[model samples]
Target: MRERRTIIDAGWILLLLIWSVTILFPLIWVFYESLRTNQEFFQDVWKLPSELKWSNYRKAWEAYGIGRAMLNTVYYVGASLAIGTFLTAINAYVLTRLEFRGRKLVWGLIMLSLFLPGINALVPQYILMRDLHLTNSLTGLVILDSLSESAFYLMMLAGFIQSLPKELEESASIDGASIFQTFFRIIMPLSTAGIVTVAIFKFLGLYNSFLGPFIYLSDPKKYTIGVAMYQANMIMQYKTDWVTLFAGLVITMVPLVLMYIFLQRSIMEGATMGAVKG
Candidate 1:
């Protein structure tokens, strides 16, 4: 039994090491490639550059208009995060804490929607956006992203909320707190872990979103990072400047990587806390 356990542990460790290498190698290669000139990269794809062409980054930034796109992305992400987080929190709180007619049916419909592919609604959504004249602007994107419901985040928050002690809510009520007061002042504070987790997920989704922005936005000035990256890739066909494209890709990853690094612990905690109830 002891020998078998040791063998299993060794197998798991080896598998993890392989997994780590597979994930890290591409990132390492991309960064290294980003330092080389297009000529150098095409000549020797596997070899390191003799000298780093740091100007590739500057060229990419200027050529692709990534700065403007990043600013637009920040607006979309910020607005979506604020509006979506608040609405999701309220939706979770209502579903988990309140008693009302058709509540289960509403939740069932939400859950059912989760299994449906979003692509199925693309035409309808696009038509709606076009009709509202929101197809080309960040405000329109934010409204579309925020107003839609996320059943997964809702369920996670609902589960976490359900796990909280009932006495706290009762005590708040006994102390003359209204439902709104109890939610904002007491429940919201205590649910920080879950909220942060959902916010991070939402931010990542919004930031890396390509499909929505690609379809809705036509102007280069209003493009997000995802669309900007696509534009960079397209430029490669004409310019053949792979290094600049790589540099843009690297820049695009920095914000998301930093965010995950900072919030990993909270994300894990929220996942665990939510699982405790359901």
Candidate 2:
């Protein structure tokens, strides 16, 4: 039995290594390619660069407008992350912790969206944005993103909130604390793991969102990193500056990767502890 378990563990480790390589290879190759000149890349795709051309990143930032797009993404993502996290936390706390009429009905209605495909709502959302004259605005995008709650996140947060002891709320109430006070002071701080997890998810999704920004914003100045990279692809058809594009891709991925690396502990704890009710 011991020998069999050891073999099974080894098999799992080997499978994990393969998966890691599959994910990391593209990122490493892109960073490698980003250091090469376009001439070197086209001459021999497999050969290492004789001299690193770090200027590709500068060119990507200045000529291709990646820097501006990154800035746009930061503001778009930051604003929505703040709004969405706060709103979702409060909503989850209310639904799970507070007693009120139609709570289950409201939750059911929200969860109903999870059953339907998101593509079905795109046309209607576009029309609403256009009608509101919000199609070309970043603020409009922020508002839309903040209000559009994810059922999965809501459920995760609700689970976390439900697991909290009611004794805390009762104690807070004995001291004449209001619902708002209890939530802001006690519940919010205690639910840090779940909130951080949700924020990271929101941040990553908003930063990488392409279709919404593509459809809503026509102006180049308003483009997010995803849309900017897409525009770079279209321009590359004529110019073929692969190295610069590679640099731009690396630049786009770095911040999010670093964020996930730092917060992965919180994310793991939240996902595990929230599910283990007993």
Candidate 3:
């Protein structure tokens, strides 16, 4: 029996190792290659660099004009996460806690939208942006991403809010607090887990967003990391300076990787708890 248990543990460990390698090997390879010069790439792509090219990062940063791109990305990500999370929380609060007419139909409509392909709306969205002269603007991008995310987050947060014990709200309300005060000061604080989960999701999407910026922002100066990376690859006519490209790629992914690593536990617990409606 002990032998069998040991064997089972070994099997699980081996499977986990394989999964880790599958996820991490690409990132490791990128790091290795990013330190190599263009000459080294042709000589032996697999070989280690004679000396690490730390300056590859600086060159990539300047060449891609990633300073401006990063700023734009931060604005887009920060605004979308802030606005989207707020709207989703309020939407979920109303749907789960408050009495309202046509609520079921409203929820049904939102669920139906989840099945619709986002691509189907792109052409129409572009046309609307053109008509409104919102293309090439930061505010337009933030609004678009915020509205784009409403349905999914609303459903996720609604499930979490519905699972909370009603007694808590009742007890708070009995203390002479208005409904707004109860929600803002009491319920919203308890719902932080769900909010953080949705915020992380929005941050990932908005930070790495490609399609929206690619279509909307024609101005090179306003490009995000996604667009800037694409241009870096394209400028060399598809044979991009591999070292610089890889360095830029690493820089682009590092912040998000660190963010997830730091917040991963909260993200997982919140997401799971949010979905587990009683």
Candidate 4:
């Protein structure tokens, strides 16, 4: 039995190492390729550059407009994450904590939305944006992203909120705290783990969103990083500047990698807390 358990543990460790390599190898290759000149990259796809071409990053930023696109992405992502997280938290709180007529029905509808294909809503959403004269604008994109509720965040937050003790709320009420006060001061603070988790997820979604920005914003100046990446790829088709394209890709990946590196622990904890009943 001891030998069998040892063998199983070794197998799991080996599998994990393979998984890690698969994920890391592409990122490593991309970064290395970004430092090479187009001639070197095309001549030997697998060989390291004899001399690093740092100018590739500068060209990507200046010529390809990655800098401007990055700033635009920050605005869109920031606005959407701030508004979306607040609304999702409040919605989850109300659904889990408060009692009212048709509450269960609302919950059921939200659950039903989870199973529905999001692509089905694209036409209606586009029409609505067009009617509002919001298409081809950053504000329009923010409105669209902020308004769409994530059932996953709602459910996670609701689960976390459900696990909280009711006595804290009751105590606040006895102390003359209004529902709003209790939510903002007491509940919100206690639910930080869940809120941060949801916010991170929202940030990633908005940061990486390509389709929405691609369809909604007609102006090149308003393009987000995702769209910018696509545009860079298109330019490469004609120019064959693969090194600059790789640099642009690396720049786009940096924020996401940094965010995950810093917040991975919190994300894991929040997920665990939400899953387990208190």
lDDT of 4 by residue, 1-278 (tens): 99999999999999999999999999999999999988988899899789998888998999879889989998999999999899999999999999999999999999999999999999999999999999999998999999899898899899999989999999999999999999999999999998998898889889989999999999999999999899888887679889889998998899999999999999999888877853
**Higher-TM-score candidate of 3 and 4:** 4
RMSD of 2: 1.3
Q: Is candidate 2 or candidate 3 better by lDDT?
A: 2
- Model 4, residue 84: distance off in Å is 0.5
- Listed per model in order, the count of residue pairs whose N, CA or C atoms clash below 3 Å is 0, 0, 0, 0
- Residue pair clashes in candidate 1: none
Give TM-scores for every candidate, taking all chains together and pairing residue i with residue i. 0.97, 0.97, 0.94, 0.98
Leading candidate by TM-score: 4
Alpha-carbon lDDT, every model: 0.91, 0.90, 0.87, 0.92
Q: Which regions in candidate 2 have their CA more than 4 angstroms from the true location?
A: none
Q: After superposition, how far is residue 209 of candidate 2 from its true place, in Å?
A: 0.9
Ranking by lDDT: 4, 1, 2, 3
- 46-84 per-residue lDDT for model 1 (tens digits): 887889999999988998898998999999999999999
Itemize residue pairs with steric clashes in candidate 2. Answer: none
Task: Give the deviation of candidate 1 from the true structure as CA RMSD.
Answer: 1.1
| Candidate 4 ranges with C-alpha deviation above 4 Å | none
Residue 9 lDDT (model 1): 100
Model 3 compared with the native: what TM-score? 0.94
